[model samples]
Target: MSTVPKRFEILLVSEHVEDRGGASVEDSAVRSAVVEATGRHGASGYPIYEGHGIVADIDPETRTVEALLVDGRELDYGLTALVRTAARG
Candidate 1:
């Protein structure tokens, strides 16, 4: 996979969130928060393009959040940084 992948997964971890402590790694609260935070028109503080978008899917079973980017325009440095930051979170 390239540095920036069209499809990437972000592990749901406590470092990415405020609170932690659950019987299972697939905590419902964290999964829901990640989904909403990375979803369309979300509050992740990331830029939203008019024609392009990134779809975030949460899999509680895997305790992971995946983002599939649909870029209509050319991928640039800023977008790459954005993905990197999102992946970090």
Candidate 2:
């Protein structure tokens, strides 16, 4: 018998600050990439946005996941870490 894959939700929040000069990432592209990466992990991913970051509710059983891929690199940090990193960059 085969086990059913679990479903997860991924939320990406991005806030556009005036000082940032309206700089922002392409949301649609990111969503598509996340969906594809999640599929590869034998799980379904749903991408959501709030302000200027990402929120993901993943299975604890999942050991690894490509949270975000940008500029030929992959970010595997949690929502909080990702947010902090983005703030610094």
Candidate 3:
């Protein structure tokens, strides 16, 4: 594959979600924006360096992050960007 898939197997989702951490990852507002951004805009291809957001030296307000996705031999441009962006504050 060329992109890190946004795939979540049925079993994984059920298990992971149930094992929620101390709190939620995104609030209603940010979550909504994310859904619209990726769901509607089809925006992807944000590069991730270390483990932080895609673009370095950004502020906590940056909600989105960009990173290189590696699923075996696959690269997911959209997933990479999504992961990094979401990682930001």
The top-ranked prediction according to lDDT is 2
Higher-ranked by TM-score: 1 or 2: 2
- Model 3: lDDT equals 0.25
Better of 2 and 3 by lDDT: 2
Which model, 1 or 2, shows the larger lDDT? 2
Identify the runs in model 1 with alpha carbons over 4 angstroms from their true place.
1-52, 70-89
lDDT tens digits, residues 1-89, model 3? 34432211110012124444565433211211211122221224332232211122111234343222222233332222222233233
RMSD of each: 13.1, 11.7, 13.4
Off by over 4 Å in 2: 1-5, 15-66, 70-89
Give the least accurate 10-residue stretch of model 3, judged by summed lDDT: 7-16
Provide the global lDDT of candidate 2 against the true structure: 0.31
Compose the digit string of candidate 1's lDDT tens values, residues 1-89: 41222233332223343444444434322221112232333243332222124344333234233333433333232222122123344
Q: How many backbone clashes does candidate 1 have?
A: 0
TM-score of 1: 0.19
What are the lDDT scores of the predictions, listed in order? 0.31, 0.31, 0.25
Top TM-score hit: 2
Model 1 error, position 64 (Å): 2.0
lDDT of 1 at 41: 36
Compute each candidate's TM-score over C-alphas. Answer: 0.19, 0.21, 0.18
